[model samples]
Target: MSKNEKYSHESYLEYQGKYKGIWGWLFSTDHKRIGLLYLYSIAFFFVVAAILGLLIRIELIAPGPTIMDAQTYNGLFTVHGIIMIFIVVIPGLGAVFGNFFLPIMIGAKDVAFPRLNLLSWYIFILGAILAVASQFAGGGAPDTGWTFYVPYSSTSSTNVIFALTAAFILGFSSILTGINFIVTIHRLRAPGMGWFKMPLFPWSLYATAWIQVLATPIVGITLLMVIAERVLQIGFFDPALGGDPLLFQHLFWIYSHPAVYIMILPAMGVVTEIFPTFSQKPVFGYGAIVISSIAIAAVGYFVWGHHMFTTGISYWSRWFFSFLTFIVAIPSAIKVFNWISTMYGGSIDLKTPLLYAISFIFLFMIGGFTGLTLGALATNVHLHDTSFVVAHFHYIIFGGMGFAFFAGIHYWYPKMYGRMYNIKLANIAWGVLFTGFNVLYFPLFIIGIQGMPRRYFDYLEQFHTGHFISTIGAIILIIGIFMMLFNLIYYRHRGAVAPSNPWKGVTLEWQIESPPTHENFEEIPEIKTPPYLFKKES
Candidate 1:
């Protein structure tokens, strides 16, 4: 038995019976339960956000505020983006998967700071509650974009301050989780596990955690300034208060650009895991992929200026920002190349996880390539703030992050729940989603090329056709999402019983029993080789 398990009480072994009902779930702090708490909570928010997304798409189908007024539509997209990014996607991967699997993957008893990990979950819950409360609080919803760009955002009629405050609190939770992971990795590896011997997903979390610790605080402080400007009327971002709005952009993007890294690094980790297991080989160039993750995280922060090129920032600064933006793409492209190369000659298995990984590669490629176009100062002058920007970000955020999040969930579901979902149904869901995704975003490229600004509830005659096609695609996309969620969650109790290593994956997590016991391992397993070194004999 593990050392911690030896000391743990009999009550610890009875995790399932700790509380008789929902209250048990609300208060439980076992990492697995906390992970499931995140799973259900984040998934709930995702459904809410999807409804808002569908609403936005529906209104755009025929254009000119078909279902609601302009202000209502503005509130819809704002809340949708805010809730999805802050409440769902930000916490979805790292907190949900990392909290549950990181310790188990590395052969540890618990996170270095277990109670603090619990506290972080509570803080996240509080932040999520505050975000939801903004809808019913003073103003209907914050009309400010997720970025919360200032001066205009500061002076908006909506409850911008409350929403920004909620976001800041969430950033605290994210930073703490990152710190816990970094310390745990430093102190808690199993007997023979070296840096290279660690699994790629946790390594990705390690890199992502550093970005969280370092970059999240910048945005936190920036949001604080926004709240101060609103409440105390301090003019840090206000020209009338003798502050430059441009400075706000500078500070915001410092965190916000790296914040994109916060969003995608975990997803990269997901793809990294899927490619190796499904390919049935050691990950090709594991060291290169690791270096590329760090490179992307480090370089990600310098590229935020590309978002400011057309905002009247200096031309010299614009050129510098543009250069860095293009430079950041190199590391990301390297990751994609490595993933494809890993699958090149291996025995490919097209399971649900592999399907998501394949989609991630395609969608992220489109998102990345389009980003290059927007990064060039000359090209951005034409595309800035258009539907093009909308399409580009969704491709990265929704397409890239969304697909990878699914990959992780499907990849880890058997281990976490001790059940296997219906494979044919899961693949059908993926097929629908794949078609729906391209149909939905591809037309935005058309409307953007023809000039339709985003965040406008109303638009011109020229943009309607493409908008309609995109809206129909959005409906298809939502259907696919619902089917996917149902299969994953509903099938848990009804699904087939799973084996520990159903997919023949080589990771340490697969070596343990499904729905792992209170004590994660039978014993602390030694790692004599690096992760993903598949053995043919087994």
Candidate 2:
């Protein structure tokens, strides 16, 4: 950065608002501070869920009661899924990076409703607390396997009510954020920035916001129905009470499947930003990527029926869902092709961020293709509840969205914190994390094909080898997780001071001061041309 840029403004970290120390952060409506709050909390839940997942892998190593009993195993996996899916996956990227970067990228000071943004974070915490409290309060931990399917959830003597209430509350937070982002994007762009000229990351968020606004309320009401099913003895999903169990499935997956886009669309946005910067080239087919993001969100809604294939739905329904499933894959595939083409012959940086971005494509492709197998009616019946589905879900969520989270953090660390981490160490952690992920999940596909059902505490001797190998991979994965987290944390406050535009990024965020001032721009920029402009590389 030039000397003129060095002493211009106090970074957000140093800016003292009305409230002093911790209180400033706790009640502040500053979007960057709110984003950091999400970063810390979501990172905590990720490690929490990851530890539960590791213990799960350990228990399955030898097939018969390795570390925990059957009941404990079921409860562990249920809580793990609840936390990872509801808290970590749904809000991690959009709440953290999107909150921090979206306004800045669009040349605004903060989101349209800054106080509403802060309130959403508090609601997220409240819901998260309730979800965790369900494990230990009043009754046994919920064992409905995150699906909380039907009669069992209704009748189970556990804290299912608490979990249900928690999820319901969390949906409110999501809805508010969706509303906030839509208005922010619509009203806050820099003066000459038209929709087409806006960056792709914001476009992905735009599409995702619509899904959040429209789809989340369905599941929120569905959870209330389930709660009523148990407390009011209503016949919502319980068949014995004259309710169709499939009703719950339909309602849940309608929101939950689009919730998949909620998790991934912003992740797609993050990598979309990374690819152009790291490749040192304008994105290939930018308009197509923008369209595909919206396309994926639109098509994602109707494909939920594929998850219910074996539940005895009608033939036409089956064909409709299965067809839509494949159709949805077309847009996702378009994104992958565009990413690769973006890097075709450009000056690829091969940095830690790029590495994770590339891995996301590889693993997400595996997940997407495997998704096809489940989308086919015949194959869906075969793989419906198997370990194969488990592997595919992780490959998509953890491998795709999770890795993209890492990439976004690394790519934006310099700008967000005004410090730099050890590049050599970051790259090494990436390799270990990548290797451990594939080693752990890839085996499940094979064992699942051999007929190992999921949610089982034990398996036959035939599946032992795959389970054992997967367990070891989990161990390696945990080590890498800590290693990566430690490196980032250690450097967050102490690393070398970062330049304003460390990656030579051409976006508005890179043009501003690192750890930007209270008002992002001293004066809002007027955009004259499209984004992703390039200068000669060193």
Best by lDDT: 2
Q: In model 2, where is the ten-residue run with the lowest total lDDT?
A: 1-10
Q: Kindly provide the TM-score of model 2 when superposed on the true structure, using C-alpha atoms.
A: 0.98
Clashes of each: 0, 0
On the 0 to 100 scale, the lDDT of residue 204 in model 1 is 90
* CA error at residue 263 for candidate 2, angstroms: 0.8
Q: Please, what are the lDDT tens digits per residue for candidate 2 over residues 50-108?
A: 99999999999896898889988989999999999999999999999999999999999
Please, what is the TM-score per model? 0.96, 0.98
Model 1 TM-score, all chains together:
0.96
Cα lDDT for residue 149, candidate 2: 87
Q: How well does candidate 2 score on lDDT at residue 142?
A: 92
Query: Which prediction has the highest TM-score against the true structure?
Result: 2
Candidate 2: the clashing residue pairs are none
Quality of model 2 by C-alpha lDDT: 0.93
